[model samples]
Target chain A: MKIEVIVFGMIADIIGKQKIEVNNCSDTTSLQIKLTHDYPKLCQQKFVMAVYKKVITGNTNLNNGDVVAILPPFAGG
Target chain B: MLTSKEISRYERHIQLPEIGIKGQELIKKASVLVIGAGGLGCSALQYLTAMGVGVIGIVDFDKISETNLQRQVLYNANEIGKYKVEVAVQKLSRQNPAIKFITYCTQLTNKNAIEIIKNYDIIVDGTDNFATRYIINDACWIANKPLVFGAIHKFEGQLTVFNYKKDNNTIPLNYRDMFPTSPAVAEVPNCSDLGVIGVLPGIIGTLQATEVLKIITGIGTVLAGKLLFMNSLDMEFYTFEITPDVNRKNISIEEYLSYDYGQFCISESQNQINEISCKELKELLLNNRNTLQLIDIRDQEELPKVPVLEELLIPLVEVIERVSEFDSSKKIILICKSGIRSKLAIQMLQKKFGLRNLFSLEGGITEWLKN
Candidate 1:
């Protein structure tokens, strides 16, 4: 399955602003693994994934129309 | 003029049924201590002052730098080289003459954190570093004062209320519940490294100020058990439900003072640390006494190249895979777009190559241009 990954913070700097659609994603949780597989640069950073504004762990299931976000650790105070 | 001033000054706030006269009165009587006069603190102060928060105490030891002006809106061109708290007090005072502001131009450490926090009914942790954030948390927890916390990164921010006591138990999760362990400094980049959008703090800081008012007035669903994580890129907010474990309970002042909060979160000594300014590097280059191998470890894409006469290029991420390219005997000076990645590179190189004469330029190329 293909998924759209939205990046923020320093992660955006690596992936750039454009949303990338890639294959090998089974669900919202597995999308991170596939994206990092496709783009090895993302593997270095720690992130939490969200599906439609709710944080989803590795066990979360996803569907076709869900929006997935890759949130990185914040630097602001 | 006076009637119009009263009506116009708080027309938006007074319109809220939850924040009418009684809530506004509570705001007038509230004394809040805000730690760090950086991005979040500056925004929090702006709203609190405009809302007529009676007393605001600002704690920051950092002076205004050219870089801070981007997100720290309270300071401007004229305020450069001035103390943040001193400058913040002047600007915020001008914004609302009715409110009283206190400035503490000192660092919040284990030694003075408690006494500094005692004067306020609520505390806001706008501090950037892990050490300071944990210190503020412990200080607020010990004092039994409610905390309005806000943090921001490149395009993301998190806000939460901690230690707000209700009956026999406390409300919401403290900082510890959210982050049981601190990410290593190298793992997480600072605002300078990541490049925070200017308007991001304005959004997060206002949310923090909103929480502070809610805490004062005892109204609204305060972010007690949940952490509100917002991403500005899409303007999305995710409220994560945080459950406090046994660690949140039985926290005492003695436990706080005795513990090394930094070590608790980050395990491992940050080694191979060396820093010099770009101006100093230039002098050493000219003198020819240092005999240093200046390694430019930044990505080739990052530019406005360093002016060092002799330098080698090696991006930080590829340093390990390409370590054999550099000679171990030579004294090395690492370089990156900013000083952060260079420091991380130095740590990695030391573990692989052992400690040779190595140093990094402080503030990297960014500071070099200024000097």
Candidate 2:
């Protein structure tokens, strides 16, 4: 299954792009591992993951063409 | 009863059926306290004033900088050295003469937050730090006032209303519900370092002001249980529902008072290492403590260097690899631009080398420069 990942805020800066497509990722954990493996800098930052606009935690299952977002809380005014 | 002059001045607002005579009157009677007169406060104050909010308070201790002119629309080049709230009051008063403006030139602390916020009907958090945001949210919860929250980062912005009550028994979700605890400071880069588009705060702040107006007039759905996220890069808006956290309930004032917001937000291991303030660091530096070893963990590009203190430069990213250079026997002090990176560096060093003599400079060089 392929998942479409959208990154926002500082996470986008670290990832070097707003959107990316990852292959063979079936759940939030696998996708997180795949992302951290590809971009080591992501491990240093804190972010929240949302699937289909709903924030999810732990090993939530992901389906084909699922849209995932990596959002870091913005502290700026 | 509005005078003919007042009626004509608010004619556009009066013309709208949703905010006609009664709504305008309610707006005129509403009291709002806006914390931080920076980017968000500048826009929030303007709209709130234009909408005829009877009483508005501005709290900020910062003086205007030339950089602030790009986004803090309330200040101009001439006002660079002036206090933010003083200048904001001058600008907002001219924008709407009928509204009363109160200025607080001091930073809001646990000692003064609840007392000052208790008098206002609504609290608008225009602050840029998590510690302050948590303080404001906790204060609002204790005071039972609705809070209008706004935040911006780069091209993205977020807005939400917390603790808005429909009745006595119903408890709404708050900042803690969305973020149980403040993110570690190193994980969150401030606008000063990361940079924000000048108009991001303007848009978010105006939205916050709009939420306040809606709450006052009882005309629209408040963002009480939802978080609105907008990305200007794509102009995509998303709202996510937030549920109340049972563990965050029944917070007492004593807990808020005892909470080390600064330490909690910046350092993950508060008890593991010693933390020194800028003043203490300065004193140690002045005393020429031979046993003290200062290491600046900030990137070389970070500005406002400590010219007065002699320190070794080792960026946080390089700390793990360069751990062999430090002497664990010496009292090690880590410094960074905002003190956050240094704390992270200390944690890294402690974990990698088992060095227990590490200490992070609280507030970093930014606080050092101020002193």
TM-score of chain A of each: 0.78, 0.95
Q: Using lDDT as the measure, which candidate wins?
A: 2
Candidate 2 lDDT score at position A6: 89
Task: Please give, for residues B105-149, the per-residue lDDT of candidate 1 as tens digits.
Answer: 886777688898999999988888766787887778777778888
TM-score of each predicted structure versus truth: 0.79, 0.81
lDDT tens per residue, model 2, B279-367: 88778777857888888877677676767654688877678778887878788898877666677677656665777888889877877
lDDT, residue B21, model 2: 86
Could you tell me which residue pairs clash in candidate 2? none
Question: DockQ for each candidate?
Answer: 0.44, 0.63
Kindly report which residue pairs in candidate 1 clash with one another.
A76-B152, B172-B224
lDDT of 1 by residue, A1-73 (tens): 6566666666777787735665656676567677777678887676666676655444567666566767665
Off by over 4 Å in 2: A57-59, B167-171, B246-250, B263-296, B300-313, B316-371
